[model samples]
Target: MPQNKQIHLDNRPTGEAELSNFKLVVGETPALADDQVLVRHHYLSLDPYMRGRMNDSKSYAASQPLGQTFQGGTVGEVVESRHPKFAVGDKVVGFGGWQEYGVVDANQPGVLRKVDTTHVPLSHYLGAVGMPGVTAWYGLVKIIAPKAGETLVVTAASGAVGSAFGALAKARGCRVVGIAGGPDKCKYVTDELGFDACIDYRQHPDVKSMSAALKEACPDGIDGYFENVGGYILDAVLLRLNAFARIALCGMIAGYDGQPLPIQNPTLLLINRVKLEGFIVSEHMEVWPEALKELGTLVATGKLRPRESIAEGIEKAPEAFLGLLKGKNFGKQLVKLV
Candidate 1:
């Protein structure tokens, strides 16, 4: 029997997650039953949404049970299978958690699916062509519904979802502006990703200053906004919103640490008539096939460029996730479990 190394949630985090909250253990892989497949993970996705799962309170998804393997998306290859649908050597992507291997049931709907690595890389599926890409697509194409010649702004501009959102908006002939944490990220957002402008949020001391910078970047005012990091960034964007603008509320990393980070300008939504809506990507699986097809083509053709910040091993996942919450990562954060 092969020993499987796994990382489990040792304790629920009250504030920011600490390294002590997780534990690594080695276990034996069980014999495959009928309609089962054993997968050895190659890449594990470390996303901000996983932080919410660490809390004991109710959320869109269930709280990760203590002493269980931390839940996450994984891209891997089938090592063994008793299922008729899957065979050995099959490459798959699924919610396999933070482990070296996963035994997945083939009967579960939307749990496991094979991926083609011929056009796009395997790791790219976890970033650009997977959840993040579909997230960008949903917010941009479905929610924001931006028209050509409009101005669109996205927060966390250098991140996986935000970068893809900006690129997709630019492709639609919209002038896209990104708001990132630092000068380096701002430069990459504008120069590399081809955003019309990028505002370094760190350069501004307050929302007033940040709003002015946003006004300058978006001369026509923001017609569509893809919100990722909320709080002050949300307030700043609200202050500059054009009438009848659309806002896609994707994430709020500011309050992920169990802090009380409420929106300061709720009145803007009424005054500006902004269509602000929050969404969980998993709930909107209907449009995934359409979104993935477009995203995959863009990635394979080099039209869409999504970056990654990779950690070497499974043991490094906790630290990588912590770095992600603090904006230390450049793009999509991934753990190379292989």
Candidate 2:
């Protein structure tokens, strides 16, 4: 049996997640049974949603089990296969977790999928053309339902989902604005991602100041919103919404560390007659094929040119993930396991 390096959840976090909560382990790879395939992960995705799962609380998804490989998305190549649908050397994407390798039952539908990496990089499958891209599509197309010439704003604009959201919105002829943490990220959102404007939230830390920034950037009033960070950002956006504006509440990352961040004035939703909906993209798998189709085209045709921030090895995943939660990573936060 081959030895495998894995990161496991040693303990659940009480308040904020710390490095002590995780432990790296060296273990022997389990033998594959019938209809199983073994994959050697090349890149591992680190996302904010995983933070919520670390709390061992009642959430939309189950908590990450202690003593198991930390759950994560991976893009890799099959190294061994006992399943007829998969073959050795086939590139694939799956929920392979935080490990150098993973095993999947090929008979289980959607657990594993083969991807073509001719035009797109294999790492992109875990980001822009994968879950994050589909997430942006669902929020903007299904929830916000944007109209051309209208103003649309997305927070975390330099991150995976936000960058993809900008591209999708631009393709639709909507005026897109982004709100990122720092000046560099804000600049990338506008200059590289092609967003109409990007506000630096760090400069305007309060709702009043952020609202003023939005007022100047979005003089026409916001027609739609895609929120990733909650707290003051959401509060500020509510003040700038036009009547009947729609909001796609994708992620409230501000509260992911087990903090209480109540929306200051939820009544604004009523006053503006806004349509705000919170969603998990996985729940709406029906839209994946359609969303991935468009996202693939954007990446293949140079429309969605996303950048990435990759850590060197599996041992560095914890540090990379911690940095990601604090908005330290520029674009997609990935760990290069190979």
Candidate 3:
């Protein structure tokens, strides 16, 4: 067995997260007990949702435990297995957290999952074809169900969830418009991701400016919205929504660090007759198979080409993750542990 390096939460962040909140330590992957499987993680996913988990506050999920490996997702290969269902060298995805190695009890169902990397890249299991992809599917299909020819808008448009939502919505023959921060991301959303239009929110700092931009981009008015970034962006989107627009509230990255984000004129929801629903995709177990199959097919067929920004090692995870929270990473944020 080798020394396993892991990052643990030492304290909860009071405002914005700082490096001091997490401590990196060297530990060992203990010998596998009966029915235990050991996986050597190749990649660690860094997502905005994990930032919310870092705080000891009431949320959709419990706060990530202190002194434990930071909770997130990982894709790797099983190096040892004592269980009948898993074998050595099988590619797997699991909630491996911020560690080089993860041990799971195979007796627990859904603790780890075998993945096929023949068509989809192994790292993508943490992004486009995995939880992020499934999240986009559930939000768009189950919540904001858009009809063909209707206009739909998504914020954080070049990130994992937003990218998947764009591809999925486009396939349904809807006009997909994306909102991102800069020229590069906005370009990728329209050029690579095939969105009908992309709005650069950086060019429009205030809700008034943002609404003007949305008006030009979505002249038909937004019929559905995939809300990844809530704040002024949500306020701006509200102004352009047509009557009876649907909103799938997936993330509120702007307020993840205990910042207050009061949506101005929330009465817009009433006036628009909008169906706004906040969702945690893990709670919807029934949609996984259907979502994964569609996302995997989109990736395999090259219709949904997702991009990634990967840091080199586990030591860089914290910095990379902080960059993710600030929208510095270009695409799906990840750390290559191996």
Candidate 4:
């Protein structure tokens, strides 16, 4: 039998999670059963949604139990396979938890996507060309369906999904406005990603002022909103939406920190007949391949750039994850595990 180190949920968090909330334990790696492949985890993807999983509360996914290994998506190399579909040395992406080695059932959902690194970097498959890529593509092109002349607003605009939304909206010929925390990130959204404008939300005093800033940048009114942080930003965007406007609610990062949900601009929605739709990328799995293919082409052509906030080693995952919740990461947060 082999051995591995795994990180488990130590206790349910009260508010913000600290390193004490997780426990790192070394144990014997479980033997693979039929149709299972053992993998050596190379990278673990730390996302904001995982924060919801730490508490014993109702959510889109079940809350993880105490002492159980906290689950997450990992990119790994197959070390052994009892299944015929996978062989040793195959590079694949799947849910491997936060461990040095683990067994994965081939039939499980979110199973490995075989990676070909000849065309792109392996880590990117976990990021831009992966789930985040698919989320941006489908959320914008399919969900919002912004037209060339439309104005699009994206919240948390410096992060991976938000950045993708802004950049892809720009590529589709929409006037894109990004809302980021600071000047550097705001500049990155405008100067690097080619957004029409960017609003530094941290500097703005209130949602009304942010709304006014958005209005200044988009005199035509926002036709589409690619929302990442919900709370007040959503409220601000709601007040500025044009007639027949579309909003793709990607992730509510602001509300994730235990803030109360803000009320919507009901009168505007009623008058404008705006369309606001919320989605999880997993629900629309059928559209992922086509979206990834399109996004991959964009990356190959230099039209898109994927940003990553990489923290080395599995032990740093908890810290990295906490940083993500605090909006410390600039892009996709990843843990490089060896």
Residue 133: error of model 2 in Å? Answer: 0.6
Off by over 4 Å in 1: none
TM-score of 3: 0.99
Per-residue lDDT for 1-338 in model 2, tens only? 57899999999988878888999999989999999999999999999999999987899889999999999999999999999989999999999999999989999989999999999999999999999999999999999998899999999999999999999999999999999989899888988889999999999999999999999999999999999999999999999999999999988899998888898889999999999999999999999999999999999999898989999999999889999999899999999977
Q: Estimate, for each residue in 31-58, the C-alpha lDDT of model 1 and write its tens digit.
A: 8889999999999999998999899887
Each model's Cα RMSD? 1.0, 0.7, 0.7, 1.6
For all candidates, the clash counts are 0, 0, 0, 0
Clashing pairs in 4: none
Q: Rate the local accuracy (lDDT) of all candidates.
A: 0.91, 0.94, 0.93, 0.83
lDDT of 4 by residue, 1-338 (tens): 67788899998777778889999988998888999999998889888888888877777878878887789888878999998888999989887788888788887756776777777777777777878878888889887998889998888788878777776787888898889989988888888778889999988858889888988999999898888777777778888889999888778777675656866666877888988888888788999889878777777777777678999877888999999998899878999987
| Count of clashes in candidate 1 | 0
Q: List the residue pairs that clash in candidate 1.
A: none
Worst ten-residue run, lDDT, model 2?
12-21
Quick one: best lDDT, which candidate?
2
Better of 2 and 4 by TM-score: 2
